[model samples]
Target: MVLYLQYNRGMTPTEAGQIMMLQAVMMTICAPIAGRLSDLWGSRVLATVGCLIIATGLGILVQVNDRMPLVVIAGSMMAIGLGHGLFSTPNNSTAIGTVAAAKLGIATATLNLARQCGQLLGTAVLSLLIAIFFDGRSITPQGYKDFQSVAVWALSISLAFSLMAAWFSSRKG
Candidate 1:
């Protein structure tokens, strides 16, 4: 969304769309690597590292204001997508592995619910920040930058939760 909003500035729509397209390409490229890492190490480790990297990327993206927010966002998206690929399948497998077969349904439901709740919280917080910071004035590069800064703050908090989750998941029961 930040990248999309960046288009409201002087950048052309084509350029913004291309940035999104590049994100897709990078995600595709990273998915397999993520899977490999999950296989080699553990899902918890990979996910924790990926989440940290993503948080770092977002934090850095806000600070850098070159004409390259697109590139930066794409890289961050790829890190995140890779983390998802690494964490999701293996984490699900681990969940099932930990629980009895009869409880698999409940486990899956819990996972999905947690995911949705997190998404809801993130969206709500982001909306509030944008409303507070992004005045209805014309969307300028500075406005978009402000949006990015707020987003980084939100993502950092989210990443903290993810890190905690990873740590808990890795603990021996």
Candidate 2:
């Protein structure tokens, strides 16, 4: 996103980050609601729905281009953020809840570890995708179209992962 904003849209980092803030704002607002709902309906359904929403967002990103407006990008970013907000608590609670009481600490630690690892992996994947379409330093003006392709491919990969997560989330514990 920062890359696209900078290279493709000619946005400053501050501007790009401000645009990204829409996502965080949506996530912050929705998380508690998702938590409350998860408590009622249980993690499986909410988690599944959350992941599906994320996939939907990424599906939109999979078609993004230079001509696309920030509003659309911001909307999809909110979908991604909202999906994660809905996903995290329920997923964590269920993962931790399934553990024996005596092992709760270990379960929490394990869950956190997995989350960190996933974040690292996700970043690495995105970085690699960017690297594929960009030179080591930066994208040239001519490379905006290449970067667009990169974004599409990267988002498609993420969309696939979200779908898989939804599938897994739908399963019995």
Candidate 3:
């Protein structure tokens, strides 16, 4: 979004910063509330709902165009923020809770490692997709279209994985 705003839309750095700030604000407000709700209600339902909301947000983003309104973009970002806020706390709690006291440190480290690995993998995949799609082309309408296609594919795959997570969370031990 920063790149698109800077390169395609000619937005100033401050403008981009403002847009990102909006997302940050949403995330900050939602995270603790989501965490409290998860504590009371359990992770399964909260996480599942988060995943679905994230999927819906991504689905909305998949259709974004250069001409899309700032409001729409901000709204999508808010949805994503809400989802992440809802998903992270209870998911971490559940993972840590499943381990014995003797293994708590190991479980925490493993969970953090998994998260970093997932981030790395996601970055690599996105980079590969961008390389394949861009092929040395400048940002253009066609390039944006290609990006949209890649984003749709990535988001769809993410949605499926999140749904699987939700399903697994819902399962009895």
The best candidate by lDDT is 2
Model 2 lDDT per residue over 3-118, tens place: 77877889999999988887788889888998899899999988999999999988987888877888999999999889989998899888888899999999988988998998
Instruction: Report the C-alpha lDDT of model 3 over 1-173, residue by residue, as the tens digit.
Output: 55555555567989977876766777788778888997898888887777777777767766666778878877887887888778778788888989999999999999999999998988797777778878877667657667666666666667667667667766723
Model 1 poorest 10 in a row by lDDT: 1-10
Query: What tens digits encode model 1's per-residue C-alpha lDDT throughout 46-85?
Result: 6556556555555554444445555566676666655555
By descending TM-score, how would the candidates be arranged?
A: 2, 3, 1
| Leading candidate by TM-score | 2
lDDT of 1: 0.63
Looking at model 3, the pairs that clash are none
> Model-by-model lDDT, in order?
0.63, 0.87, 0.75
Question: By the TM-score metric, which is better: model 2 or model 3?
Answer: 2
Steric overlap count per candidate? 0, 0, 0
